[model samples]
Target: MKNESQIFGIRAVIEAINSGKTIDKLFIQKGLTGELSKELMDLLKKGNISFSYVPIEKLNRLTRKNHQGVVAHIAPIAFHNLENLTLKVIESGETPLFLILDQLSDVRNFGAIIRTAECTGVHGIIIQKKGGAPVSADTVKTSAGAIFKIPICKVDHIKDAMFYLQASGIQIVAATEKASCPIYDIDLTPPTAIVMGSEGKGISNSVLKITDHMAKLPMYGEIASLNVSVACGVFLYESIRQRL
Candidate 1:
């Protein structure tokens, strides 16, 4: 049997799409041309799924078996609907607490945040489609199965999700070192979604510009930064403390 984590070959990938598999991303051979490749490309565009064409060597590196110019990475768990999830949280008389991960590419950090979000009763976790880490086996293991317990939404853009959440009366707060106010000082008990950026570049400028509040964690040591997951844990636990 083929690996559940990867769908290789053109026909197999097309079948997976038709069968409603949760495909995280597709990598195709650059300049690949044929009726089959054209059909796959058309299907991808129709579904609004993203794909990238790379050199054949890249595809070969990902899989030794015959990939037939395409390889699709499958999401570990099915994604949840953000609109339905947000509405449900509000209707149930629970303040919606969402965790928005912006372009985070580290599997371990992503998993750690999922584990923390589940423990803190976060309504759901949102990840951008393009740059976020795929929910693969390593992520599932690092999360200790918390990835299965929590609701996760994969959106095309984090900014679009931010706008929707804002319109629904959810305050968008970002955790960045540049903010003057400490994370503990933010009013996190309200319907809120905490946006944590990647460790490398921090939050994107576009998303940061629209936030309702910007807060930072205290730094005492010579090191001015914390691991993304560790920072996320601190922010989450503080919110939990305030809500109690």
Candidate 2:
């Protein structure tokens, strides 16, 4: 991790959290606990910060400093609140174009998708705090710095985010292989939010059940699937093409 990308040590992380810093991801040593650490953990949960427990060796790989069982990666960009962003876009009299990523955990893929999103004029990108990729230095590099140009919203649950988007009068367009509809056939010019799924698993069934539209790219190769990032580019650019 780059020096600017992360904060090591428990107290430093706690301070960053207290200051309302945007932490993209957090790692703590397995079985970590001190009176201070417990306090930090409590604040993390109350704030809905996403974190994971990792081996001390993993922490050593990230940094040589005394981490005291916790490390936090600073988000490459400030996170936007989905509800506020959604409403703000509508109030501005522009068609709301959002990209929702469901558990796309590969940092490289996440970065690539954001790069395409920025190119497509996507208004914002939404992801689940726990299941999605961490916005690390590698992610920023892979994104060609597009991460800084876009708003990323980290939500508690993908389904909840979908529901809120629907309620906000945005049509949710999900891309999945299981769907029969072609991507280019959709009405992308509306107030719309497109959902892209994880590299390993497609969007969760709970999320798919609520989608306003489901689309799939035309396939001609023997391989039945496209990479998550490539699929996202196809979806986003098609949305762009339709709008244009």
Candidate 3:
């Protein structure tokens, strides 16, 4: 994920996907109506490629080219398979520490969290293919090259990823705003993966369904919540402290 590059347009993206390149997600103008757009949507659905339907203005901001009302960002690093990574960690006789981003869209926050996860010996990071931040140059700079070292896996859906992790004997602990149990009270020594949500909304409903433990940070101030990255740091460090 260290190298930086730009990928644009619909046909180009489709080719990238077909070529087995890892794409973060595709963005299509919200109101697009035509045969080509329709075909692209069908193709994405069939391939389990996640995409966002955004306003034309959003697409325009990305590039001035005839973009064909579509744009896809390539992930800076190649994503690993969840099953393989989980098995590898277990085979190494290590407690698996994984981080899942439910729908985090902030690039800097994503990078900072990745940096913390890597430093803390997390085994892998799982993020939804859509609605998550793309690993752009900003992310690499924010992480200071940590993104290059850590393993990241993109799943078609976060809920599905959670289920897979749970099946692999990894406990799914959610860092949420709604939980009554503070993160400090949780037992993190088990094979565990902590789930973080976006700044605008906490963990999505689908992901919340499969979480084994729900933990929240203790906040006494007027502010209702901590920044996503700050919350991630607190949760990850707590796990590190417990393991030590």
Best by lDDT: 1
Runs in model 3 lying further than 4 Å from the true structure = 1-4, 18-20, 29-47, 53-55
Deviation of model 1 at 156, angstroms: 0.9
Error of 2 at 24 (Å): 1.3
* Pairs with steric clashes in candidate 2: none
- Across 1-244, the per-residue lDDT of candidate 2 in tens digits comes to 4578789988899899888788888999999878989999899889878789899999999998888888888876788898888888889998999999988888899889889999988999998888678888778999999999988888988889889988888999999988888988889988899999988888889989999989999999999999999988888888778878
Better of 2 and 3 by lDDT: 2
> Which regions of candidate 2 fall more than 4 Å away from where they truly are?
1-4, 55-61
Query: Cα RMSD (Å) between model 1 and the true structure?
Result: 1.6
Q: Residues 34-126, candidate 3: write the lDDT tens digits.
A: 876677778788877777888888887887777888877777788888888889999999999999998899999989999988888888999
- Identify the superior model by TM-score, candidate 1 or candidate 2: 1
- Comparing candidate 2 with candidate 3, which one achieves the higher TM-score? 2
Candidate 1 local distance difference test against the native? 0.92
Q: Residue 205 deviation, candidate 3, in Å?
A: 3.5
- Per-model TM-score, in order, reads 0.96, 0.91, 0.86
> What does the lDDT read for residue 201 in candidate 1?
94
